[model samples]
Target: RPLLKTALLGREIVYIASIDSTNNETKKLAAAGCVEGTILLTEEQHGGRGRLSRGWFSPFGKGIWLSVVLRPRFLPQEAPKCTLMTAVAVVKAIRKVTGIPCGIKWPNDILYQGKKLVGILTEMNAEMDAINHVVIGIGINVNIASEELPPDLAALATSLQIETGQPVSRRELLTVVLYELEQAYALVNTQGFDPILEQWRQLSVTLGQKVDVIGLNNRFSGVAVDIDRDGALLVDTPAGQERVIAGDVSIRPA
Candidate 1:
């Protein structure tokens, strides 16, 4: 891990040729008292998962599939800020490495030219007021061609290669990602969430747009106005302003 410039993250990495899910493996290690900043990286994931229990497509040697173990000293309610931090880090890394300027869709999806380029799923083991560990799972489609993606995902997903019209080095991209994440994590600890939130806003594509949010039992259409301190999306509806903490957000045509 010498190539990584981060002080804490990626210091101890476990690399495997294939696994069911990096997040699952990282959770197992976290429960066994693995140190914070430990990373679980796999070349292939057979049973990868996304938010809302969706399956992630991870073919062998086509993308970056990994999970990071973090032990942040923050309350359970502040966990969503970590997801925002991750989005900023990923966006910064992609822009720096591949020159593909990307934006973040609320919560944790990275997009390029309105197509998804990266997905992040953050899970935490915590109580009401305390946190034991947090696992940040990230998947970035790097070299996969557009035609190689599944038919269902062809219009919804994209890879770095497709966006930039060139191949990207996964190793270099991962290193830069880790470094950027470390920097953002440090900022959250030292400066609090305001600075990180500002960066998130600048890189966000969801704010100030009409959106439709689908929750478990309810759906609403409104204009996304702002993100609260707790990282909740504030949607301005016809009735009033609504705060959405968790849901699927889709930007609608204005």
Candidate 2:
């Protein structure tokens, strides 16, 4: 779109009325040699997904359901940094658009006043050491009302409209998101992950908190100290310090 000020991201967008999943479509495109920066935007996603294989709640014309195809020249080990960078970008975009404070929970969830406002899922294809492509899926609850959400999610999920007491233009938000993402991606490509990690720490709600992390077969409670260079969470447990690469983190009260 003309409103987008990014150099690469969102330059070639595939807009659809409906789809099973934007991530899935973007992967297909990436496999067929689609150029980097190609994006897929849909009004509705029938089978949207989130991190840890959880189902994302996506209703028609109520949210931003989109995925971007990227071919960054980073190794697979550095992929998690992309996810963290995206969280920072989304937080900045939300604050700029709605003037509401938002923070990122570790890994990928964006929180506003302790409730989830956005979810990001990043998937990548790689060789042993080199990444072939990455699809960053972003879903933001933009205009959904409180009552419209299921009772199970009513307590944990929120939207921009709900927080601001007015509808937000998805078009404007999407353009800003692309611009922010492009800036962050450029930072990662040029300067490295340190700047992105620093910004993420500034907007984090999980750091310096007692928390519980639930992995596939392991769980632990600790004080989240910092995120390592690889983007794994470093927690000080009763036994010792541990680095968590993948898990569901729940922040405990101070």
Candidate 3:
């Protein structure tokens, strides 16, 4: 409550103990004229989802699963920038609260060492040339022990308690994340993308490396060049090619 009040002052609030997906619920509320700054939270998500429709693992009371609804006046094309901004905010919050060094993978995965600790999915409703609303879903593994992770994710995932050698407060971490989110959101609207992009670059772990991009249509190998103004990744491909956007990339050491 304190976090939402600080991050979204004077806005309608919604809370749920269990939901199919926080992002989906946020979208429904937005379509029904829910105001900006409204938030939806759940302790367990039966149908939790990740980017590209992948299933997200969310156990009951084991992680932070929440979504924030926004009614920004930005153009539809600029929505991607907001996801990157959110990543920056999350990394900042993680560092501030836990004193752990977290790096952002392209798009919205937070990594520690080489394991994923959090994932963010952003969904938007748009009209012609303008955005109606955006629902940013954030999932963080807070107190889950290493033994509790799914077999597939056991070797590839870590939690706050696992990384920090002690349990951490989910409420405290969520508060820091929401506070940083408000700051980043305001900066993106007023200052532009450069500032956020710079912070993203500093926290990014995928830049200037060999990468294998696995997209919906095709897969290709490339060297990550930079992030464009619209936040799509720039890559240098084979056959002397250059591309502005690549998704699901596997970054390799140079």
Candidate 4:
């Protein structure tokens, strides 16, 4: 059956049994000028990585490990919207597939009760004004069992089966996610990023919370008040308000 009902996404799916990283593979294809919405999926990713180069645990056929290639007309400065939009798409898919309400943590991590459920990595290659290609890497913990998770990640990660008390279909979840992504992707690139930003705020777990952000050369603790127009995190700190473009955010003890 054709699981995808979208005009753009999954138009050409490169499925592999195993790979080092779907994002890496997709990036190569993108560099060679793969069409927009070319999806590179793998049953298992041996060297999957998340934001900040953190290892993503993808074992065998238990999860959805994939990356989509997009050649959007967005300027380099507007690249942050891709991560925000992708997070919303995954959140919508999780709600429909498992009926579990998951929240997005700042830039791109999807979590439920502080446990990570999905991670989105949006990487782009571009000139100063225009983007060459954007590879959105999405890793969803779908059918991995509770006890089967690695000891290091057991406390901090979760799967759909663990939340729903039954096995959820990865194919179905992936289909819905891709469909939602295509919609959000088009909307953000066409209409504007504000609409998707509003949806991101609604499902945001980082907002209205005391948090700490670690950037490349700065770190600060503050209250996450809101997001800016370009999807930067606006934090209210003791010094003043800080606009964080890319950082590692953790909820601080209140």
Candidate 5:
């Protein structure tokens, strides 16, 4: 709590040495009517998972594995914007700490040099008209040594140590991330998602690129053009423009 002096987020924390997943933990807390800004932070996640339930490479003391609980008054349909809000916050925090300019993939994947640096997953417990609470999970590869990562993951993932050739202080990075998120959340509550959406578009690497989006039941190819207010991708396909909410997106040859 001393390291993180944020006003809105991280006021209440549940720090665990090891856990299945921070998101799952936060969900339980959120269900029990925990404080709105409570955070679930784990040093290690033995069963961490990402957007498509793919196992996340979260070795102990190498990355940031955490989830934030929010009780926003927004409708259920507006929950997805929180993911967008988090992506911009983390990107800004990373740049401030490491001086590395990273870009955000569609929805909320942070990438550097075409390899994944961070991933965000958001879950909500809401009714049709209102939201009960939300748990947004964020995983960042901070000081993970390259060799410690699995062979399959090392090829497609990176860390702050590998990007900068030196170790990073996870504490400092996590503090900055929470501060940024608090500020962004306050902005969204005061104004709207317009400003954040504009910032997301500016920091987006996927926009204006030819990409393939594979959903649960459909696959399509298109040029990534824009994102909606709710952070859905707006793609111009051969048939027509399609609104993609959640999918496995891969940028292809333009």
Candidate 6:
């Protein structure tokens, strides 16, 4: 147990034993002009959220539930790319620190052995053409046992301890993840999305795989080919073709 080392980036840090949600706390601080790299972490989240309005199950002291506030100088249109950036950072950090192979499912779920180990939620307060700030919420299943998961999620979700056959230090993993996030964020802000997008493709497990994307109007099946600079998934569908900006992507392995 070493203490977590975050990017710091000139922002203050806040930690709590329990909270409604780290994202909610970070959003409030950001609205009050919290500096970049300000992080809110809690051991438990009473009302944790997932993508698509789903509620996440986070018990006390069993996971890494945290949110980061970032003020990237980019237009609102360029926001989705930040999700991709965070996904890449998480995957890289897991591999770097633990030597465990991990991959990204579209949008922002990190998977290992076809089970989700991480979930990311990104929110932005935008007006006109600019974004005031983005709150990136990251929930990681760190030290839980397989038997600890709820009956419904036991089949689809997994923890790092279950995959590694031993408990991992939450602080260590968080440090690495924050460092990687800062690096990727800087590259995207200074260089562009091309480099990060390329790296994202290399670490992605969904590309070239047949996937079912649950769209607003209807569901469609296609082969995921690539992701655009705007972070939209390009799919080659049988019924002509299409691009998906947002959806629940399910991979159908060959």
Candidate 3's displacement at residue 219, Å, is 1.8
Give the Å shift of residue 10 in candidate 2: 1.1
Q: Give candidate 6 regions above 4 Å deviation.
A: 1-10, 247-254
Candidate 3 has a TM-score of 0.93
Error of 1 at 133 (Å): 0.2
Ten residues in sequence with the least summed lDDT for candidate 2: 245-254
The clash numbers for all candidates, in the given order, read: 0, 0, 0, 0, 0, 0
**Model 4: residues >4 Å from true position, as ranges?**
247-254
Write candidate 2's Cα lDDT for 124-205 as tens digits.
9998889999999999999999999999999899999999999999999999999999999999989988999999999999
**Candidate 6: lDDT of 93?**
90
What is the alpha-carbon lDDT of model 3 when measured against the actual structure?
0.84
**C-alpha positional error of residue 248 in candidate 2 after TM-score superposition, expressed in Å:** 7.1
TM-score of each prediction = 0.97, 0.97, 0.93, 0.96, 0.96, 0.94
Model 5 per-residue lDDT tens digits across residues 68-158: 9999888898888989999999999999999989989877689998889999998989977999998999999998888888899877899
Give the residue spans of candidate 2 off by over 4 A. Answer: 247-254
lDDT of residue 113 for candidate 6? 86
Instruction: Look at candidate 3 and tell me the lDDT of residue 167.
Output: 90
Candidate 4 residue lDDT tens string, 56-161: 9999999999899988888888888888999999999999888899999988799999999998899999977899999999999999998899899999999999
lDDT of 5 at 66: 91
Instruction: Write down the lDDT of every candidate, Cα atoms only.
Output: 0.90, 0.90, 0.84, 0.88, 0.88, 0.86
TM-score of 5: 0.96
Tens-place lDDT per residue, model 1, 8-126, is 99878899899999999999999899999999999899999988778999988989998999999989988888899999999999999999989999988998878899999999999
Model 1 root-mean-square deviation: 1.4
lDDT of 4 at 210: 90
